[model samples]
Target chain A: MDVFFQQLVNGLTVGSLYALIALGYTMVYGILKIINFAHGDILMIGTFIGLVLVMNFHLAFVPALLLAMFITALMGILVERLAYRPVRAADKLIALLSALGVSIFLVNFAQLVWGTETHPFPVNISGEPIILGEVHIGTLQIWALGVSLLLMVGLHFFVNHTKMGVAMRATSFNVDYARLMGINVDNIISITFAIGSALAAAAGILIGVYYDAVYPVMGYSAGLKAFTAAVLGGIGSIPGAMLGGLLLGVLENEGAAYLSSGYKDAIAFALLIIILLIKPTGLMGRREQQKV
Target chain B: MLELKNVMVNYGVIPALKSISFKVEEGEIVTLIGANGAGKSTILKAICGLIKLKGGAITYQGDTISGMGAHLIIRRGISQVPEGRGIFANLTVEENLGLGAYVRKDKAEINRNLKVVYDRFPRLFERRKQVGGTLSGGEQQMLAIGRALMAAPKLLLLDEPSMGLAPLVVKEIFKIIKEINQTGTTILLVEQNARMALSVANRGYVMETGQIISHGTARELRDNEDVKKAYLGH
Candidate 1:
C-alpha cells in the first residue's frame, strides 16, 4: 500500500508536466487541424534556452523561466510565419511534411549549438521531501503540480472570459465566418502558436528540474509521451489533453512499478493501442459534428 | 451609398466577376436576382472584401474600398450574412450576437444595439443561451440576421436569406427584412428566390452569367414578360 501511494505521487508529478506540454499539442491541433510535429523539438530548444539563461546570464531560476518562455514564444511565431503559413493553403500532407522538416532542422540546430551534452539542472528547492505517514513527496513535485494547475486554470479563464479568447474560439469554429465578424484570422493563429509554445517552455523547464538534467534530444521522448496523452484524451479537446496526461502518467508509473521497470514505455504504448482500438475519438473525444 | 465600377474578380485566371458595374443608392433595398453560379453571391463577397477584385474599384460613400482586407472592410459599415447562414454553431446565441459588435468601441451603444436586436427578434432573446447549431433552421436564420444587426451596419449585404426555409418561414423572414429596411439600413440582397426577392426590393437587377442583363424598378421588372417567365414563375 505504501509503495502504491509513493508511485501515485511520483506519477502525478510526471503527469503534471505532461499535461502542460500536451496543451500545446491540443491547442495547435484545435486551431490548425494538424499535429505540429516540430512541437517537441521546440520544447527541447526551450529547455536549452532556460539552461543558458541560468548558466551564462546568471539569472535567477524564476526570472530565467519567464524569459525562456518569452523567447521560445517568439521562436514559435517565427517558425509559424516561415514554415507553416506558406504551406497552409496546400494539402494537409504538405503541412505535415513541412512540420517534419522543421522538427529535424530544430533538432540539428540544437545539436550544433548545445553540442549534444546532458547538463545538470542546477536549481532545486531548499528543503527535504515532505513525509506523510509512509509516503514522501518532493518539494519539486509539489511545485510542478501547483504551477501546472495554476496555468491550466488561467488558460480556462482566458478562453472563456476575454474578447480575444472568444475570437479564438470563434475562429476554431469557422475561419471565413470569423473574418466576416472582423476577426483578424492570421493574428489569432499567431497568438495560438505563441501561447502553446510558451506553455511547452514551462513544461520543458519543469521536466529538467524533476529529472535533474537537460539534453538537446530530450524533447523526442517527452514530446512523444505528451502527444500520446493528447491523442488519448482526444487530440483537439483542451480538457481532454489534461485528463489524458494525468491518466497516462499514473498508469505508466503503476505498470512500471508492479509489472517491469524495463517495459515502462512499452506499457504506455500498449495502453494507447488498447484505447485507440476501443474508442477512436479517444476517452472524451466526440467525432467532429457538422450540421447542414 | 455603394458603387462598383467595372469590378472584375478572378479565381486564379478564371474570371468570376467580369467588369460588373452597378450602383446601390442610399435608402433603397436593391435586389440582385440570379441563378447559382451567376455571380450574385460573388458580388457580395467582393463588396465585403472576402474575395479580391482583379480589376476596377468598389467605392462606399465616395471612398474607394477596393484592395482593403476583409477585416478592415467591416469598419466601413457593411456587414454580410453569408450563404447557408454562417452561424458559429459551437457558441451561444448571445456570444454570436456579441461577436457582431466586435469592432465597436462604444459600450453604451453596443448595449443599446443588443436590446434593439433582441427586441426585433424576440425568439432570439428567448434562445440566447442555446448553442447556435441546436436551433432549428428558421431560428438559425433569425440568429444570423440578428447578429449582423448588432454590428449597426449602414449597409447590410444579405446573401440568400430565404434559402432552405419553409415558404411560411421565408415570408416571415422577408417581412422582417422589409421592417429592418424601414428602420433605416440600406440593403443589398442577393437571392435565387427571385419571386420573394422582387416583392420586397424597391429596384431590381436580373443577372445572367456574371453580367447584369436587365435592370428596372421592381414593378417594371415584375410586369416584364422576360423576367416573369425567367424568375417570377408566372
Candidate 2:
C-alpha cells in the first residue's frame, strides 16, 4: 500500500510536467491543426534560458521562471512568424516538414551553444523532501504540481470566460467564419503560440528543478512523451491533453515500479497503440464525420 | 454604399471572377442571381477581401478597401453569413451571436444587439445555450443570420441562406431577410433560387460564368423572357 501510494505521488508529479508540455502541443494543434514537432526543442530552449537566468544572472526562482517564460513565449511567436506562418497555407506534409526543419535546427543550435554537456540545475528552492506517513515526496514535486494546477486552472478560465478565449474557440471551429465575424486569425494564432510556449517554459523550468539537470538533447525524449500524452488525451482537446498526461504519467510510473525499468518506454508506447487501435481519435477527441 | 469596379480574381490561373463590376447602393437589397459555379459567391468573397482582387477597386463609402484583410472588411461593417450557414459547431448559439460582435468594444451596445437578435428570432433565444451543431437545419440558418446581425453591419452579405432547407423553412428565412432589410440594413444577397430572390430584391444582377450578363430593376429582370426561361422555369 505504501509502495503504491509512493508510486502514485511520483506518477502525478511527472504527469503534471507532461500535462504542461502537452498543452503547447494541443493548443498549437487546436488552432493550426499541426503537430508542431519543434515544440519539444522550445522546451529545451526554455530550460536553457532558465539556466542562464539562475546560474549566470543569479536571479531568484520566481524571477528566473518568469523571464524564461517571457523569452520562450517570444521565441514561439518568432518561430511562428518565420517558420510556421510561411507554410501555413501549404499542404499538411509541407508544414510538417517545415516544423521538422525547425526541430533539427533548434537541437543543433542548442548543442553548439551548450557544448553537449548535461549541466546541474541550480536549486534556488530548498532541496528538502516532505515525508507524509510512510511515503516520501519532494518539495519540487509539490511546487511543480501546485504551479501546474494553477496554470491549468488559469488556462481553463482564459479559454472559457475571456473574449480572446472565445475567439480562439471560434477560430478553431471554422477559421473563415471566424474571419467573417471580424476575428484577426493571425493575431489569435500568435496568442496561442505565446500561451502554449509559456506553459512549456514553465514545464521546462519545473522539470529542471525536479530532475536537477538540464541538457540540449533532453527535449527529444520529453517532447516525445508529451506528444504521446496529447495524442492519448485527444490532440486538439485541452482537457484531453491534461487527462492524457496524467494517465500516461501514472501508468508509466507504475510500470517502472512493478516491471523492468528498461521496458518502461515500451509499455507507454504499447498503451498508446492499444488506445489508438480502440479509439483512433484519442480519449476525448471528436470523431470527424465526412461532410459531403 | 459599395462599389466594385472591374474586379478580377483567379485561383492559380483559373479565373473565378473576370472583370466583374457592380455597385450596391445604400438601403437596397441587391440580389446576385446565378447558377452554381457562376461566381456569385466569388463576388462576395472579393468584396469581403477573402480572396485577393486581381485588378479592381472595391470602395465602401468612398474608401478603397480592395486589398484590405477580411477582418478589416468586417470591422468596416460588412458581415457575411457565408454559404452553408457557417455556424461554429462547437459553440453554443448564444456564443455564436456574441462572436458576430467580435470587432465591437461597447459592452452595453453588444448586450443591446444580443437582445435585438434574441427578440428577432425567439427560436434562437430558446436554443441559446444549445450547441450550434445540434440545431436543425432551419434553426442553424436562423442562428447564422442572427450571428451576422450581432455585428450591426451596415451591409449584410447573405450567401444562399435558403440552400438545402425545406420550402417552409426557406419561406421563413426569406421573410426574415426582408424584415432585416426593412430595419434599415442594406443587403447583398446571392442565391440560386432566382424566383424567391427577385421577388424580394429592389435591383438584381444576372451573373453567368464569371461576369454580370445583365443588370436591371427586379421587376424588369423578372418579366424578361430570357430570365423567365433560364431561371424562373417558365
Candidate 3:
C-alpha cells in the first residue's frame, strides 16, 4: 500500500509537468490546426533562459522564473512573426515544415550557445522530502503540483470568462466568421502563441527545479511525452490534455516500477497507439459533422 | 446606404465576380437571388472585405471601403452572417454573442443588445449556456443572426439563412429577417431560395453566372414570367 501511494505521488508530480507543457500543444492545435513542432524546442530555450538568469545573473528564483517566462514568450511571438505568420495562408504542409525547421534551428542554436554538457540547476528551494505516514514526497513536487494547478485554473478563467477569450474561441471555430464579427485574427493568433509559449516556459522552470538539471536536448523527451499526452486526452480539448498527461505519467511510472525501467518510454508510446486505435478523436474530442 | 460599382473578385485564376454593380439604400431589405455558382455570396464577401476587390469601388455611407479588411468593415457598422451559420461551435451561446460585439467599447450598450437578443429569440435564451455546436440547426441559424445583431450594424448581410432548414424553420427565419429589417436596419440578403427572397425583399436582383440578369421591386420580379418559370414554381 505504501509503495503504491509513493509511486502515485511520484507519477502525479511528473504528470503535472506533462499537463502544463501539453496545454501549450493542445491549445495551439485547437486554434490553428497546426502541430507547432517547434513548441518542444521552445521549452528547451525557456529552460536555458531560466538557467542563465539563475546561474549567470544570480537572480532569485521567482524573479528568474518571471524573466524566463517573459523572454520565452517574446521568443514565441518572434518565431510566429518571422516563421509562422508568412506561411499561415499557404499550404498546411508548408506551415508544418516551417515549424519543424524552426524547431531544428532553436535546438541547434541552444546547443551552440550552451554546449552539450548537462548543467545542474542550483536549488534555491529546500530539498527536504516531506513524509506523510509511510509515504515520502518531495517538497519540489508539491510546488510543481501547486503551481501547475494554479496556472490551469487561471487559464480556464481566461479562456471562458474574458472578452479576449471569447474572440479566441470565435477564431478557432471559423476564421472568416471571426473576422466578419470584427475580431482581429492576427492579434488572436499572436496571443495564442504567446500564451502557449509562456506555459511551456512555466513547465520548463518547474521541471528544472524538480529534476535539478538542464540541457539543450532535454526538450526532446519532454516534448514527445507532452505531445503524447495531448493526443491521449484529445489534441484540441484543454481538459483532455490534463487528463491524458496524468494518465500517461501514472501508467508509465507504475509500469516502470512493476515491470522494467527500460520500457517506460515504450509504455507511453504503446498507450498512445492503443488509444488512437480505439478512439481516434481522443477521449474528449467530439466528432464534427458537415452539412452538405 | 451601400454601393458597389464595377467590383470584381477571383479565386486564384477563376473569376467569381466580374465587374458587379449594385446598390442598397438605407432601411431597405434588398436581396440577390440566384442559382448556385452565380457569385451572390462573393458579392457579399467583397462588401464585407473578406475578398479583395480586383477592380471597382464599394461605398458604405458615402465612404470608399473597397480596400478595408473584414474586421474594419464590421467596425464601420456592417456585419455578415456567413453561410451555413458559422457559429463558434465550442463556445456557449452567450460567449458567441459576446464575440459579435468584439469591437464595441460600451458595456451598457452591450448589455442592452444582449437583452434585446434574448428577448427576440427566447429559444436562444433558453439555450444561452449551451455550446453552439450542440444547438439544433434552426437554433444555430437564430444564434448566427442574433450574433450579428449584437454588433448593431447599420447594414446586415445574410448569406443563405434558409439553407439546410425545414420549410417551417425557413418560414420562421424569413419572418425574423422581416422583423429585423422593420427595426430600421438596412439588409443585403443572398439566397438560392428565390421564392422566399422575393417575398421579404423590398427590392430584388436576379443573378446568373456572375452578372445581374434583372432587377426590380419584389412584386415586379415575382410577377415576371422568367422569374416565375426559373425561380417560383410555375
Candidate 4:
C-alpha cells in the first residue's frame, strides 16, 4: 500500500510536468488546428535559459522562472511568424511538413550551440521530504503540483472571463466572423503562442529540477510523451490535456512497477492506440461536424 | 457613402465577380438580389475585405479601401453579419456579442451597446447564457445581427439574413432590418428573397452570373418584367 502511494505521488509529480507541456500542444492545436511539432524543443530552450539565469546570474527561482517564460514566449511568437504563418493558407499537409522541418531544425540548432553533452541542473528546488505514517512526499512534488494547479486555474479564467479570452474563443470558433468583428486575428494567434510557450517553459524548468539533468535531445522524447498526453486527453481541449497527462503518468508508472520497466513507454503508446480505436476523438473531444 | 468601381474578383482560375460597379448612399438600404452563384454574396465579401479584388477600387467616404485587411475594414466602420449567421457555436450568446465590440476602447459605450442589442433582440437576451450552436435558426440569425450591431458600425452589411427561416421569422427579421435602418445605420443587404428585399430596400441591383445586369430604384426594379418573371415569382 505504501509502495502504491509512493508510485502515485511520483506519477502525480511527473503528470504535472507533462500537463504543462501538453497544454502548449493543445492550445496551439485549438487555435490553428495544427499540432506544433516544435513545442518540445521550445521546452528544451527554456530549460537552458532557466539554467543560465539561476546558475550563471544567481537569480532566485521565481524570478528565473518568469524570465525564462518571458524569453520563451518571445521565441514562441517568432516561431509562429517565421515558420507557421507562411503556410497558414496552404494545405494541411504542407503545414505538417513545415512543422516537422522546424522540429528538426531546432534540434540541430540546439546541438550546434550547446553541444551534445548533458548538463546537471544546478538549483535544487527539492528540499526535505514530508514523512507521513508510511508515505514520503518530496517538497518539490507539492510545489510542482501547487504551481501547476495555479497556472491551470489562471488559464481557465483567462479563456473564460477576460475580453481577450472571449475573443480567442470566438476566433477559434470562426476566424472570418471574428475578423468581421474587427478582431486582429494575427495578433490573437501570436498571443496564443506566447501563452502556450510560457507554460511549456515553466514545465521545462520544473522538470529539470526534478530530473537533475538537461540536454539538447531531451526535447525529442519528452515532446513525444507530452504529445501523447495531449492526444490521450483530447487534442483541442484544455482540461482534457491536463486529465490525460495525469492519467498517462499514473498508468505508465504503475505499469512499469508491476510489469517490465522496459515496456513502460510501450504500455502508454499501446493504450493510446486502443483508445483511438475505440474512441477516435479521444475521451473528451467534441466530434466536429462542418457547418455550411 | 460606399462605392465599388469596376471591381473584379476571381477564385483561382474561375471568375467569381467581374467588373462589378455600384454605389450606396448614406441613410439608404441598398440590396443586391439574385439566384445562387450569381456573385451577390461576393459583393458583400469584397466590401468587408474578405476576398482580394483583381482590379478596380472600393472607395468608402472617398478613400480607396480595396486592398485593406478585413479587420481594418471593420475598424473603418463596416461590419458584415456573414451568410449562414456565423455565430460562435461553442460560446454563449453574451460572449459572442462581447466580441463584436472587440476593437472599441470605450467600456461604457460597449456596455450601452450590449444593452441596446439585448433590448432589440429580447429573445437573445433570454437565451444569452445558452451556447450559440444550440440556438434555433432564427435565434442564431438574431444573435448574429445583434453581434454586428455591438460594433456600432456606420454601415451594416447583412448577407442572406432571411435564409432557412420560417416565413414569419423572415418577416420579423426584415422588420428588424427596417428598424435598424431607421435608427440611422446605413444597410447593404444581400438576399435571394427578391419580393421581401425589394419591399425594404430604397434601391436594388440584379446580379446574374458574375455581373450586375440591372440596377435602379426599388420600385423600378420591382416593376421590371424580367426581374418579376425571374425573381419575384410573378
Compare the candidates by lDDT and give the number of the best one. Answer: 2
> Which pairs of residues clash in candidate 2, taking residues 3 or more apart in a chain or in different chains?
none
Off by over 4 Å in 4: A126-128, A290-292
Model 2's number of clashes is 0
lDDT of 3 by residue, A58-112 (tens): 9988788888989988888899999989998899899999999998899899889
Query: Model 2, B94-172: lDDT tens per residue?
Result: 8888898889999999999999888988999899999988889888999999999989999999999999999999999
Q: In terms of docking quality, how is candidate 1 classified?
A: medium
Tell me each candidate's TM-score: 0.95, 0.97, 0.97, 0.97
- After superposing candidate 2 on the true structure, give the runs of residues whose Cα lies further than 4 Å from its correct spot: A126-130, A290-292
* Higher-ranked by lDDT: 2 or 4: 2
Global CA lDDT of candidate 2, please?
A: 0.91
lDDT of each: 0.90, 0.91, 0.89, 0.89
C-alpha DockQ for predicted model 3: 0.74
Best by DockQ: 3
The collision pairs in model 4 are none
A1-292 per-residue lDDT for model 4 (tens digits): 8877887888888887888899899888888999898999999999888988998999988899999999999999999999999999999788888888888898888788778988888675646778887878888788778788888899999999998888888887778888888888899999999999999989988888777888887888778888888989988888888998898888888778878779889988998898888887777877776344
How many residue pairs collide in each prediction?
A: 0, 0, 0, 0
Cα misplacement distance, residue A105 of candidate 1 (Å): 2.1
Number of residue pairs clashing in candidate 4, backbone atoms closer than 3 angstroms, sequence gap of 3 or more or interchain: 0
